[model samples]
Structures are given as structure tokens and as C-alpha cells.
Target: MGASQTQLRETLDRLGLTVPLADALWVLDPAQPAPSMKTLAGQLHCDPSSATFLVTRLELQGLTERVPDPADRRSKTVELTDKGALVRGELIEAMVAQSPLAALGPEDQAAALQLLRRALAQAERP
Candidate 1:
């Protein structure tokens, strides 16, 4: 897992992204309501201040933007820009290319995915 993370970081660095920012962008759904800062913090398992800093960096890079939350006029939500989505796609491709699963056959990959999903689901349970 550490080696995989290191490879992902190297790929992201080549594209001018940090792991946190890439993670934040990857979680966003273009067709869904953008998550509020607090929600993002919860998703990232970080404090609100850290989420704010990450968002600020993404905003400066023109990869993300903050808009007024319709549900709460005083609050804001973060969404990916067109550029961010493109970059995120590239990141996905790069990560997949570097993945150990890349060497597996399609059937093996499917099996692996199923097992991994099962493990994740079990981990999520109490």
C-alpha cells in the first residue's frame, strides 16, 4: 500500500497535484450538489481548517471553485472546474497504469475487485 501510494504521489506530482487535492477532486460528483467545507472535512477525515486550506489551494490552481450553498446562504460548497475533472481523469489513468492489477487478466481483475469490495464493506461494518 505504501509503494502504491508513493507511485500515486509521483504521478500526481508530475501533474502538479498533491495527494490531498487529488483526493478531494476525485470525490466530487459533477452532477451532484458540491459538498460544503464541513462535509468535505468529514469526508477527508480532517478538520475544517485543513479542508479550507486544501480548497484554497485548488481554487488558486483554477481546479476548483466555491459557490454559495443554496441550502444555507452563509455557507459555501466546493466543486471541480472543467480543468480539474480532466486532470482527475488523467490521474485515474496514471494510477491504473501503475497498479499491480494492471498485469492481471480481466477475469482476475474482476475477482480482485470483488474481494477488495467485500473487504471494504466488512471493514465498514461494526
Candidate 2:
């Protein structure tokens, strides 16, 4: 699908996130229960070195912080800072405001959301 890169760029610009796609993905997964550099790398299908680089950049920007896992001194966990939370909230609001759901009639939007929930149910498959 050749979607609108222009729209995508404009949307990202509105959100003030200049990171590339991989870093964007990392930002989106901020609320995972136990997020880590390793987990992010696995999700992005990138190498550990690349993941580290992404994490370092985000950390430098103050969007994320690496805290030592209290239970394991050798391990660390990644968590979004207050700034990240605010950015995520704004991004989500912008997305919802621009999405087709708002333009669709209420009845149609409800039906579409129901189908989307059903599609979400397919996550059980391996």
C-alpha cells in the first residue's frame, strides 16, 4: 500500500518527533509492562547494537530514561519520562482527531469499531 508519505510527514511534524521509524516504534511501545532495550530490538527486528543506538539517542533527548532494575543489578529497564508521556498524549489526540472515525457517521463508526475489535481478537494465533 502506497500511503501518503506527505500526510505521514506532516503528522509527525505536528507531533515534534524527528526520530526515524524504528525510534518511533520504540516510543509507541513505552507503556509495555517491562520494556527494555532487548525487547525493543526484538519487536523492531533489529540488532542489539542498533537498538542500543536508538535507546541512547532517546535517552539523550530526555524522552526516556534507563533505570537499574531493583531486583537485578545487572539489568536495566527503559521507561518514558514525563516529557514522553506528554508527547504520546498529544500524538494520540492528533491521530484520533484526524482519523476517519470522526468523519464517519456515528452508526458507521460504531460498526467499524466493533469489527476492529473482532480483528484484535485474532492476536491469539501463533
Candidate 3:
């Protein structure tokens, strides 16, 4: 797991992303309501301050923006700009290209994805 994580970190770094910021960006959905800072923190499994720091870096890069939540003006949500979405798409493509699974046939890749998703879903359960 550590080796895989290291490889992913290197891949993301080469694409101009830190792991935390990349993780944060990956969670954003431009078509949906933006997630609050607290929700982002929860998704990242990090503290609010850490999430804020990551989001701030992305904001500085012009990839993300903070907007006031409509339901609660006191709270803010992080959103990806068009630029951010482009970067995210590039990141996804890069990751897929670098993936060991890329060597597999299409059917094998589908099977692998299904198995991986099932395992991930099970891991998420209490």
C-alpha cells in the first residue's frame, strides 16, 4: 500500500498537485452544490484547519474558490473553477495511464474495477 501510495504521490506531483489538494479537488462536483469546508474536512479525514490549508493552496493556484453557502451565509463551500476541472481531468487521465491496471484488457479492467469498488464499499461500512 505504501509503494502504491508513493507512486500515486509522485504521479500527482509530476502533474503539479499535492496529494491533499488533489484529494480535495477530486471530491468536488461542478454540477452539484459545493461541499462546505467542514464536509470537505470530513471527506479528507483531516481537521478543518488542514482542509482549509489545502483549499487555500488550490485557491492560490486559481483552481478553486470559496463561496458562501446559500443555506448558511456564515459557512463557505469550496468549488472548482473551469481551470480546476480541466486540471482534474488531466490528473485522472494521467493516473489511468500510469496505473498498473492499464496493461489489462478492457474486460479485465472492468472486472478489476468492480472488485475494487466492492472492496472499497465494504471498507466504508462500520
Candidate 4:
């Protein structure tokens, strides 16, 4: 079969994250400036403490920052710094580079995308 969640987790761990899903989400939403921990925890389906711990880990790596939320002073928001952005870009690029059709010519790549889109559409059906 295709890659399982565990396999994806391992790949993410290899790239230097204890919780790859959370990190990847933040990276993908870089325009957030700084997303609140509550928001992130909700997105990850985890408790606030767990999100705190993950953010701490990323902060220690100079990949993310925690700042006071302007909208709600009591809340804190997390954002990727310059280093974080660089690492995020690299990680995204690496993942894309490893795609199955990476070696295909442009026409074949287009066909592959079309096929994958159809599969995705089918899977989204109830």
C-alpha cells in the first residue's frame, strides 16, 4: 500500500520534530504571523499543555516564537522565525522532491496530477 501515518511520522521525526503533524501545520500556515496556542491545540486535537510542550521544543530549535496575542493579551501566539521559515521551506521542498512522479517528464507529471486529483475526489465522497 501507500505510506501509512506511522511512516509519515517517522519521516517527520527524522526531519527533527517530535510532533510532525503540528509542526507541518504551522509551517503551512506561515502567513498567520503568530497563531494562538489554543487555536493550534484545537487544530491538532490535543490539550493546551501538549501544544505548549511542542511549541517549547520548536522554540528551543529557533524555529518558532511565542508572543503575546494582540487581540487577547492573556493568550499567546506562535509564529515561525526566519530560521523556521527556511527549515519549513526545505522540509516542504524535500517532501515534494520525493513524490513518485518527480522523475516523470512534464506531460506525465500533469497526467499523474490529474489521476491523483480524481482519486482524491473519489475518496472525499461519502
Candidate 5:
């Protein structure tokens, strides 16, 4: 999550976004079709109530909204607004450009990843 933290810092400073809302951007994609509350719960690995709460919070901020699901009129789907899309793009770009390994070449990145994975595995030992 180092990369995420790095990106979050920049985007938060630039956009004046709350930490929770910015973190939720990880699963929110503008290019994708709107996802139902159930689908978002699955993606966030939380209960339906938690997902609803998160969606509500984002909606309050004008970052997301609940719309009628095309496939099921009774159900609602979540989608980003224009402002949300812009913020998402900025978050994505910052994440990429400010990654811990951004300065590394492909080969060096791969090599570093291997070493990091090895260290992580060793650290996981009980």
C-alpha cells in the first residue's frame, strides 16, 4: 500500500479530498459501467450495510450517486459524477507517477519486486 499512500498524499493535498473518499477510489472506475450496491459490497469485501454507508458518504460529497440499475429497476447502481471522474483520473495519474518504483526501469523494477517479495515472505514467518 506504499504506492497508494504516496498517491493519496498528493491527491489529497491537491483536491482537498477526505482520506476515506480517496481510498474508495481504488475500486471506483469511470470507464466501467455503474455497479450495483451488491457488486460494490463484493469489491470492497464488506457487508451490504457498510457498502451502502460508503456509497452514501461519497454521494454526500458529490463524488458518486445512486442511479436506477438498467437491468433491475428496483435496484440501484453507483456511478461517478463528472467531478468524481476528474478526481479519479487525477488519483490514478498520481498513483502511477508517484509510485515508489517510478524512477526504476522495467528490469530494475522486476528485480526489486522479486527481492521485496522474498523479504515479505521471510517477514511473514511466525
Candidate 6:
């Protein structure tokens, strides 16, 4: 979904969250399986200290928890708790509702997604 910075900020405020924390939640997406906390830090472009802070906040809210990485016992992965999933859903719904993309039907949204994917692919090219 599309949204302006102001909208995002407002939404986060309504959810009692900050911008970085919201971004962390989005990156901690359940679709890709559990990505390591290091990966999460990289995705957020934050230092280890910042990542620790974000994780602490998430844990305090019972939204996400650190689990032992399946591939590496020494590492941990961030997994969304059931409560986190529901909250994430609410955030997405709020964003979508505030976005112009909400007016588009499924077919139109799919076409938009296709275009965005193409744009992203092109942007990634050297």
C-alpha cells in the first residue's frame, strides 16, 4: 500500500509506536520465515545497539520474540507472536485505508504490483 510520511507517522502514533519500530515490524515479515536478528539489523540499516532496542520494545509488547536460529544454534531469529500478527494486520489495514491504492480493485492492485516489481528490478540493475 502507498502512504505519505505524515500518514505513516500518524499511523504509528495511533499504534503507540515509533517509525523505526514500525519499519522493524514490517521487515520482520512472517512470509519469509524467521530471518536472523542480524538480518533484521541489516534490513533496518541500524547498528547492533539500535537493533537491541527495537527487539526489546517488541518483546515488551509481546509482539515478537527471539528464537534460536534453526541453522545456527548461536544465532537468534525474530518470530512474530500471534499478538504481533494481529497488530501487524491492523497496521496494514490502517495504512491501506489511508492510501489511494485502497480505491483500486484487486486486478488494478495486481497490475500496480507488477509495475512496481518491474520498477524495482530495473532500479536494482547496474
Q: What TM-score do all the candidates reach, one by one?
A: 0.91, 0.71, 0.86, 0.67, 0.75, 0.83
- lDDT minimum window of 10 residues, candidate 6: 1-10
Tell how far residue 42 is off in model 1, in angstroms.
Answer: 0.9
Give the Å error, residue 1, model 1: 2.6
Ranking by TM-score: 1, 3, 6, 5, 2, 4
Best by TM-score: 1
What are the per-residue Cα lDDT tens digits for candidate 1 across 16-100?
8888887887777677779999999999999999999999999898889999999998999998999888887898898789888
Worst window of 10 by summed lDDT in candidate 2 = 1-10
Error of 2 at 38 (Å): 1.7
Across 1-119, the per-residue lDDT of candidate 6 in tens digits comes to 24455767777887777777788888878888887878888999988779989989989999999999988999999999998888788787777787777789999999999999999
Report the lDDT tens digits of candidate 3 across residue range 1-126. Answer: 455457688667766787777788878867778999999999899999999999999999999999999999999989999899998888777667767888899999999999999999999999
Identify the superior model by TM-score, candidate 2 or candidate 4: 2
Worst 10 residues of 4 by lDDT: 1-10
lDDT string, candidate 4, 1-126, tens digits: 144334445556765765454354444468656669888887777798888888888888888888899999898888887887877776666556665666799999999999989999999999
Over 4 Å off in model 4, which ranges? 1-15, 19-28, 101-126
On a 0 to 1 TM-score scale, where does candidate 5 land against the true structure? Answer: 0.75
lDDT of each: 0.88, 0.66, 0.86, 0.72, 0.82, 0.84
Q: After superposition, how far is residue 8 of candidate 6 from its true place, in Å?
A: 3.8
Return the lDDT, model 6, position 99.
Answer: 74
For candidate 5, lDDT tens digit of each residue in 26-122?
6888777888999988888888898898888888878889999999999999999888888788877887787878899999999999999999999
Which regions of candidate 5 are displaced past 4 Å? 2-7, 107-126
RMSD of each predicted structure:
1.4, 3.2, 2.0, 3.9, 4.5, 2.3
